[model samples]
Target: MSDDLTTLHDDGVLEIPISLESAGNSLDGDSIRNGTDALHEVMRGHRKARAVLLVGKGKNFCAGGNVAHFGGADDRRQFLRGLAHDLNTFTDALYATQLPTAAAVSGWAAGAGMSLALHADFAVGEPGTRLRPAYPGIGLSPDGGMSWLLPRIVGLGRARTILMRDEVLNAQTALDLALLSELVDADQVYTRAREIAADLANGPTGAYAAIRRLLMTTYSNTLSEHVIAEADAIADLSITGEGVEGVNAFLAKRAPDFPSARN
Candidate 1:
């Protein structure tokens, strides 16, 4: 990964810092590509990361794309296309990862930044955090799965209003709309996210992955198909070490020690 994006693996948590000094940790081509690469490495089992945490290094979590790059590019169309492709790749990797993911937001999460925050299974933000679509503000359409994720998160009516009106949401408003998973103090955002991730990491990692897969496929699958999928998933997980430990632990009235911790 590039210096702008740093990854730290500790205690089964993969911490990724989206850092961009000039743009306040905004999304850029290099950062997206590098960050995606890092996630790919983790998924390949290069590191035993049971959970992932995305946090910003500076004031704002992410200000979104570097708008200046658009104006300066000799071929704006090609530049934008490539940038979107890279971002899609990153988001795809994030969604496909087996590890549970969380985002810690302290300030602005605008445009694609907001999408990245929403992409996480869990998003924790402080009172000062602000979220905006930012696409309509710049006369551009949505990218980074904003169009798909927003409505699912906040409902179609609210999502339409927020995107069309270029509405900026405060932390409380976002939380009320179900855009944020949790709220914390500015200084405690990352700590709180890490705590949540650690708890997930200690649980059944395989079961967590299965849950994510099932949920992601639910919207598209028919009722009969979905039930069968669920049955298959549970049957497959039953033989995993973590599953066995969980069953035994419950019978024994003790905490389960998942085997993934030693990986």
Candidate 2:
């Protein structure tokens, strides 16, 4: 738990830990920039890693933008643009990552905090964890792909209610609504997430990335266009060496060599 916003570690398993501790008392201004920079560096260094596991220390996952740093900017337009840019950078990095990713939430995930958790491929929270979309509550709108991700996860009506009402959804309720991928005891959150990450690390990495590509394309694609895109992907994959190895492995009743992924 360093004063820096993020801590990176490799734990023998292919997945690495991207710990979000704190930058002092509050996440105020410049914290998001610092955090994102650190995360970018971590990602660059671990290009071969299979997954990212996000964990937080202290009472909450994050309390959103530092209010102390909010109103001081002289140019309102510049400030808003900077905020949007940073959020998009952070989320794009997360979503475009080749490996699987998971968030282990042990405490409160509020505002952009919830957005960060939602960005993960899978979110695992502790039993008593609380998640609040703190956007509308503070007269601010959603960012960090919240508008794009939330409705897809929980449907339009539920997403609207959560955003408009600013309700605090607990971990259990989050799981019930399909907003969370799993729930575990508070102390076991990171452990369970790590286990799952390890499993994904050892699984079909290329196939998982292909699935991610399809889902991302589906976001703005028409049905007919998506069908054409899918056909292209299927044809491309069929010619790939890994795809051939996978088919051979299945027929031979053996594990896939994934020769293309060999380091």
Candidate 3:
């Protein structure tokens, strides 16, 4: 049902577009399920893809929930609540994945879309890209991990101002706040993102996964605990074929061939 929502490329980049035919490219239950399932396949080794890339299919990256559907639901409360749950589940799945991830935010990344971008390890945007807390505009609190991700990426004070004021940040401001890793030409957003994903896919997969996990949990750990976690990570990775190959390559003054390294 959702096969079309994701495409795993031969270069090992899994591309998950924000939406299908949904209006404004807003997320739906089907799209969310499809995307999450795709990620699971990759993480479980059912698929060969080693990196994930989120892209937009239409004019806007995503405009948050389908507002018209919300207004027309027979049981608005139930329908809305279920939608939020599905979105949360999908966002959690995306965050939990160990693979490197990037998002090509070519156009407007409002509300849930903004949160989705924040989930990625890197976000490539265009000069005209815009972001907004579209949830408050609809009289709703944030969802799709927005509340948690914003404060981490942009400072607590900036995040508070952006969410409370519902400020629509332009590309420059978003980049300045570190919301966007870099900006490319509007036409090259996806291409550049794909290049990044492919490049990362060829590097040390296990090391990337370890770094991602450690970085995400650093805030929750004490100084000693975090140091031990970092130590454990290095100790574990040092025995992996990737670590051996990396060190050998560095000593030999050659690039590491992680894929060919023995597991």
Residue-pair clash count for candidate 2: 1
Q: What RMSD, rounded to one decimal, does every model reach?
A: 1.9, 3.6, 1.7
What tens-digit string does per-residue lDDT give for candidate 2 at 1-263? 23354444343233322223464222333555655565565568743455666655555566665554567778866886787787777666665566677777768777777887887788888778888888786688887787778898888998999999998998889889876799887778878877877766666666777778888778699999999988887777776777777788899998886735443
List the lowest-lDDT window of 10 residues for candidate 1. 1-10
Runs of candidate 2 exceeding 4 Å displacement: 1-46, 71-77, 257-263
Per-residue accuracy of model 3 over 189-227 as CA lDDT, tens digit each: 988999999998888988998998888887899989999
TM-score of 3: 0.95
Work out how many backbone clashes candidate 3 has. Answer: 0
Report the C-alpha lDDT of model 1 over 1-263, residue by residue, as the tens digit: 22446555566777776546566677756667777887788788776668888877687888888888898999999999988998899888877677888888879999988988888888999999999999998899999999998888778998999999999999999889878898998999988998988887777888889998898787899999999999999998887888888888889999889954233
All candidates' lDDT scores?
0.83, 0.69, 0.85
User: What CA RMSD would candidate 1 show?
Assistant: 1.9
Supply the global lDDT for candidate 2: 0.69
Candidate 1 backbone collisions, by pair: none
**Order of the predicted models by TM-score, top scorer first:** 3, 1, 2
Candidate 3, pairs of clashing residues: none
* Top candidate, metric TM-score: 3
